[model samples]
Target: MKTESMSSIPAGNLAERIRRTGASRVVLQIPDGLKREAVPLVLALRAEGIAVAAIAGDPCYGSCDLALDAVALTGADLLVHIGHAPVDERKGVLFEHLPFDFDPAVVAAAVPLLGGPAVGLVTTVQHAHLLDEVAAVLAAHGIVAEVAPGSGRTPFPGQVLGCSYANARALLAPEILYVGTGVFHPIGVQMATGRRVVALDPYTGDAQEVSADRLLRRRFALIERAREAESFGIILSTRSGQARPALAERLAALSEKAVVITMREVTAAEMINFGCGAYVNTACPRLAYDDQVRFPVPLLAPQEFEILCGVRAWEEYEVDEI
Candidate 1:
């Protein structure tokens, strides 16, 4: 029989937190990538004589997708959620945000590509801890980096989530350098600010300038396609953090053809069953931008829907966020 590796370990405070809870039973939840750590963590907890209630098997994207319901069902006193910080604080839940470290020298690859006198710096949560080191790297290159504070859904300084680019927008710089892995965020920054964006992958040491032109073109096509729809569904999430009921109601009133639809998980099948020609996502912004291919119909952002309703112009286009 094959054996699993124990090289990796769970967060340090997990056991102590369970002890502090004074709860005999506990439920653990983690993102898909970190699910492998569940067994070991549960075994360790069981060794402590704490009853392992159950593991939340449903897909968890972020702290927004808590397994509170599962906890309630299992009668677990506490829910230990890992891999993301809380977007909003909830009782009976503990958040364990995992951090990934990388060398600050990786910023050297992005400095030469930066164009203006001052460059706004932004990164994902995993790299947010090293913002100071990254800024130091830029300073060594004689480049001034603006590491602005974030607000709303993003609380970490210089950290930009898929749903929020408040940190980058706060800088208002002509050029921005995003030190992260994916081009999706760089594209979001470009779309949100209409500024030049260069993305650097810390692990690979690769750098490239990101353009919003392609995304804009695709969004334009989606908007045009949505124009032909007779009715639209304004999707509102039931998730603790993703719920945007007020915005959903406002958008629903924009057009007679639009109706508000609340769902925990907005799947292609659900949309097809609802029979809405198009959709307006008020949940996680990534669903509309990243998962458009999986959706059968055009899913419009709040701003895009406003443009379609004639309440806002296409020139005022912006990415949707919670």
Candidate 2:
């Protein structure tokens, strides 16, 4: 297990910053996987005379009910979320810090010898901190690499959740192999770039190569599973009308005509919290990409939802449609 130290200097600076801002109570939301380092940061803050509390949960993406319950118990005036971004719908001031260091030498040495003219770089928010360094290393390796620009609509600052890499991959020029880490991030890049991707394991510094064909087949499987389900659930957004309600209504009406059981409603934390069998989103379609939410059910877009709901020959829906 590779590990990096959390910033004590920044922690102190953050403490002073908070003190100047007059916040008395501080909550440190640390992901369970990375708690080994994060615990010390919380201790450092407590030593600074700042009332600090630690909330433990998986920081992979979404809010865990146990973590949320911990936050409610803390009643913190300021929340410092470590290792992940705020996946909840509630809007508030929160700080996110991802403490993972990618060895530049590892990235440089791992550059593929066979890929075409260009290379695209994709990474999750956790590993995004190393983009500049990795890009520089790739440049030195005689490979021109581009960092896929994130979707501008990320709900959290410094956090690109839900198709973030997809947005970046879409923006990339063709004939580029996207380099990413782990199954989720690389697969996301492959989905967006429509190209082969190389995934580097953060832990062992190993590389895994994935082809575009495999990703397409995986997506087909997800769609097929949704199609075989009996009841279809549609999630609506209380915010937008043309986007959420229109899409939800279309899905509901289609399900009714097909004699398939359909359920529709506004997007709620609980919908994810309690876990459903299958759901289609009328709101942000990017929710399908956020694995951190730990959605117990398969969530798809309207068209994908239709396909999953067994609507034969359903047209594919674009992410921008919602």
Candidate 3:
């Protein structure tokens, strides 16, 4: 497996750039998964005599409160966010990077021969470890395969940032096939590739063919219905809405006229970017949970959302249905 820096980002220079911008007290926020790479960067800033602090947690992709607390505590003039871009409304200098690299050999191996002239490849961060191997397999099979860059991970991949497979896919025209472990990767790949795809599980090396036309049709229908609905709110929660009963009840009632989804289902950053008019969360009461991310629309508790949607009061709604 060949590992290379995914982003052409200059290191050590960020602190200098901030200094030039007259910014001091830099707070570096990184995902819990990327601590190994993030730590050294933080220390480097400190070595440069720049005030720096590191926070360990998910950053909820800039939606968690701990992220907000880190910003407030550090009083950071510049926020060097590693792994993720800034999702919060708070304005500051933000630096982002794609922490994982695709193995070239994996990318070479996974192309399929039966799919005619060319193929499309897609995978996630977890399966990205196998890209080179998959690539090698493709080359050996005498099949031309292309990978798309920046299709996954926030900011709409190619539009705002670059993703590995997405970059490759854009560069080459091929029949699309995704090398992935689960539904999400193949689904996303199909959405981006605009082709029927073969999904491969990197761990087990198992493969399956997937069709996205049906799924996309369903999703589009749902989105259209939701958009036209008189009212809409989402029930926000982590994993599931297991913790809050009142919130769930209110959400169910609100759903009659409005669309409701979980926080896990929709990122706060996405909500803000999508321009959703209203949202009622059952999870963390704060908009964007921890406050690292902010919502532009009106965010209220489930009860408030129900009222806005003109649904029955929380007590009048059936808790069991929630």
Number of the predicted model whose TM-score against the real structure is largest? 1
Q: Compared with the true structure, what per-residue lDDT tens digits does model 2 show for residues 97-130?
A: 5546767667754576426356666555666677
Which window of 10 residues has the lowest lDDT sum in candidate 3?
Answer: 155-164
User: Model 2 compared with the native: what TM-score?
Assistant: 0.66
List, residue by residue over 186-214, the lDDT tens digit for candidate 3: 55455445566666555455566676556
Give TM-scores for every candidate, taking all chains together and pairing residue i with residue i.
0.93, 0.66, 0.48
Candidates' C-alpha lDDT: 0.87, 0.55, 0.50
Of candidates 3 and 1, the better by TM-score? 1
Clashing pairs counted in every model: 0, 3, 38
Candidate 1 structure lDDT: 0.87
lDDT of 1 at 182: 86
| Model 3: lDDT of residue 233 | 57
Could you tell me the lDDT of residue 40 within candidate 1? 79
